[model samples]
Target: MVKSADGVIVSGVKDVDDFFEHERTFLLEYHNRVKDASAKSDRMTRSHKSAADDYNRIGSSLYALGTQDSTDICKFFLKVSELFDKTRKIEARVSADEDLKLSDLLKYYLRESQAAKVRLGCEELMMGILVCILKQCRAVWLGSQRLVDWGRRNEDLLYRRSRSLVDYENANKALDKARAKNKDVLQAETSQQLCCQKFEKISESAKQELIDFKTRRVAAFRKNLVELAELELKHAKTGFLCVAPAILELTQ
Candidate 1:
C-alpha cells in the first residue's frame, strides 16, 4: 500500500507501479539534461561577463593613450573608446540578463526536479533511514504481503474443505464438522470478494492521480519555457538597439 500525503494507505496496482517506474526513468533523464543545461548557462554567463570586462579594459587603454598624446588621431581614439565603453555597458547588461533569466531558471528547475523525484518516492532516492524513504517500495511490499496472506488463507480453506469432504464420505458422524468447515469456506469467499472490490477502487484512484501528475509537470515545463523565451527575446532586442548607433557612428 502506498501512503498518501494525508497518511491514508492506498493499494498498489499494476498501472500505478508502471507509472512510478516510468516517472523514475523520466526524472533521471531530465535531471541529467538539465544539469548539463545549467552548467552551459553558467559558462555563457561567465563568457558574457568576461567579454564585457575585456571591452572595458580596451576602452580604458584607448582613453589613456588619447589623453597622453593629445592629437587628431588621439581624438578619434577617444571617440572609439567612448563607443567601446558603451558596448561594455551593453555587454554587462546582457550578462546580467542571461544569468537572471536563463542560468537562474535552469538552476531552479534542476533543484525542483530533484525534489520532485524524491517526492515521487523513487527507490533509488533515499536521504536517511526515515527521511524520504521509498514510498513506492513500501507499497509494493505491503501489496505482496497482502497477496501472500490471501493466498495462504485460500489454500488453508481449500485444504480444510477437502479434508472435511473426505471425512464426510468416510463416516456419517462427521457431518456437523463438515458443515462448519463449509461455512468457513463461504466466509472466506465473501472476504475475498470484498478485498477485490476495494483493490479495484484504490487502483482507479491511484491511476487518475498518476495521470494528473504527468499532465501537471508537462504544463509547468511549458509555462517556464515560454517565459524564458520571451525574456531572451527582450534581452536580444535591447542589446541590438544599444549596439546599432555605435555601429552607425563607427561607419560614419
Candidate 2:
C-alpha cells in the first residue's frame, strides 16, 4: 500500500492523470450544483419578499374597510388588520434574515467558484474572499494537462526511435539520421521528465487543498444554516406572540 500526498493510504495510482481529471470533473459538477442552488435560493428570497408585500397589502385593504364604517364587524376588521400588519412586518424580517444568512451564503459561494478574476459586487466582497475548491481545481487541471503533454512527448519519442532504428538497419547512410533522432529523443526525455516532476508537485498540493476546501465549506454552511434557523425561529415566535392576544379577543 502506498500513501497518497493527501495522506490517504491507498494502492498505487495506475494513472495519475485519470486521478486528477476525475477530481477536477467532480469539482466542476459540484460547482454547477452550487450555482443551481444559488439560483433557487434567489427565487426563494423573491418569493418571501412577495409574500411579505402581499400581507402588507391585505392589511392595508382591511384597515381601509374598517375605517370606512363603524360597526362590530368593522372593529373585528380592524383587529384582524392589526394581526395582518404584524404578520407583514414579521414576514419582512424573516425574508431579510433569510436573504442575509442563506441566500447570500449560496451566492457568495457561487461567485467564489468562479475564476476570481472577475470583480465581485460590493455585497459579495463584504461576504468574503473568493478562493476555494475552484482555485484548487484549476491547479489540478493544469497538472493533468502537464501529464498529457508528457505522455504525448513520450509517444513521439517512441515513434521516432522506432523509425530511426528501422532506417539504420536498412541503410548505412541513415546512421547520421538515427543519431540525430537519438539526440532529439534524449532532449524529449528530459522535457518529459520535467513535466512529470511538476505534475507530481501540483497533484500533491491539490490533494491537500481539496481536503481543506471541503472542511472549510462544510463548516461555513453549517454555521450559516444554524444562524438562519435560529433567526427564523425567533421571528416565528415574535409573530405568534404579537398575534395571540388579537386571536383570543376575536375568539371571545
lDDT of 1 by residue, 54-169 (tens): 99999999999889887888987888898888878877877776775566556655754565444443222222111211222566345434433433333233223223333333
Estimate every model's Cα lDDT from 0 to 1: 0.58, 0.58
Clashing pairs in 2: none
For candidate 2, report its TM-score. 0.62
User: What's the TM-score of each model vs. the native?
Assistant: 0.55, 0.62
Tens-place lDDT per residue, model 2, 46-125, is: 88889999999999999999998899889988999989888888888887877777776676566545422111100111
Q: After superposition, how far is residue 140 of candidate 1 from its true place, in Å?
A: 39
Which parts of model 1 are misplaced by more than 4 Å?
A: 1-16, 119-224
> Considering only N, C-alpha and C atoms within 3 Å, which residue pairs clash in candidate 1?
none
The best candidate by lDDT is 2
